[model samples]
Target: MIQPTKDEIRGWLSEARNELRSERFRRRLLEHELCSAKRALGNAVLKGQINVPIEKLGELVLKLQKESETEEADM
Candidate 1:
């Protein structure tokens, strides 16, 4: 799977929140993607493939956390 940019992820999160009208739903989606990415990174690391940058990982994690907060507030 292709890695997504932080801006692309943020846009997707925003769109999901707006379209679903449920922050919880958006959070779930974000969580699933994050888990998938982590697994992919793990596999890549084991195989000596180029993994994602640390900075991008941090950004994605922060964004997921912020989105989770939004979900909590809406609930």
Candidate 2:
């Protein structure tokens, strides 16, 4: 599996959110993306890559939590 940079992940998530027509669908997609991003981030962390800043991890977690909250609100 190829490790993706935080920027790449952010771009992909942004594109997904933009392309989605409904908020409910976007939230669902975001949750899926969070899982994929976590796996990619795990690989990067294991490789000890100094290029990808550690700050991105927290940002990713926060983004996922926010998405979750949004999803819950829709229910």
Candidate 3:
């Protein structure tokens, strides 16, 4: 079996690190999009614009609002 040289190993490690960084950035972007969608859904429910069960929608809206408030407080 041929062993990798030091430079080859370093290049592989650098590539791995770059891939991890890209994955993390993509995950963060997706998370932001999901949060936005959830908030929009919650708002629609609260406004009677969506056709979901009222009780469940109310609970979801309240939960989303609470989370938003908490995030604001943290910021």
Candidate 4:
């Protein structure tokens, strides 16, 4: 196996960090979008535009909020 030089290792680490930062940024954007979509759905339900049960929608929103929190914590 060929051994990597210190500079090579540093470069790899830098790349990894950049990639991770990019991924986190993307996730945050997506999370915001998810929240927006949830709000829109909730509004639609409230306005009688959707036929979903209120309790079911609340539960689904709660579940999604918890999942989003968990993901944020993980990051």
Predicted model with the maximum TM-score: 4
Question: Largest lDDT belongs to which candidate?
Answer: 4
lDDT of each: 0.83, 0.80, 0.87, 0.90
Which runs of model 2 end up more than 4 angstroms from their true locations?
1-34
Ranking by TM-score: 4, 3, 1, 2
Which whole-number lDDT from 0 to 100 does residue 39 have in model 4? 88
lDDT of 1: 0.83
Model 1 RMSD vs true structure:
16.6
Tens-place lDDT per residue, model 2, 1-75, is 989999999999998887765776877798799779888877878788635566987786788889879978988
Per-residue alpha-carbon lDDT of candidate 4 for residues 1-75, written as tens digits (9 for 90 to 100):
999999999999999999999998998899799779978987998899989976897898799879979978987
Clashes of each: 0, 0, 0, 0
Q: Rank the candidates by lDDT, best first.
A: 4, 3, 1, 2
Q: Who is ahead in lDDT, 2 or 4?
A: 4
Error of 2 at 41 (Å): 3.2
Q: What CA RMSD would candidate 4 show?
A: 2.3
Q: After superposition, how far is residue 5 of candidate 4 from its true place, in Å?
A: 1.1
CA RMSD of all predictions: 16.6, 18.2, 5.1, 2.3
- Candidate 3 vs 4: which has more TM-score: 4
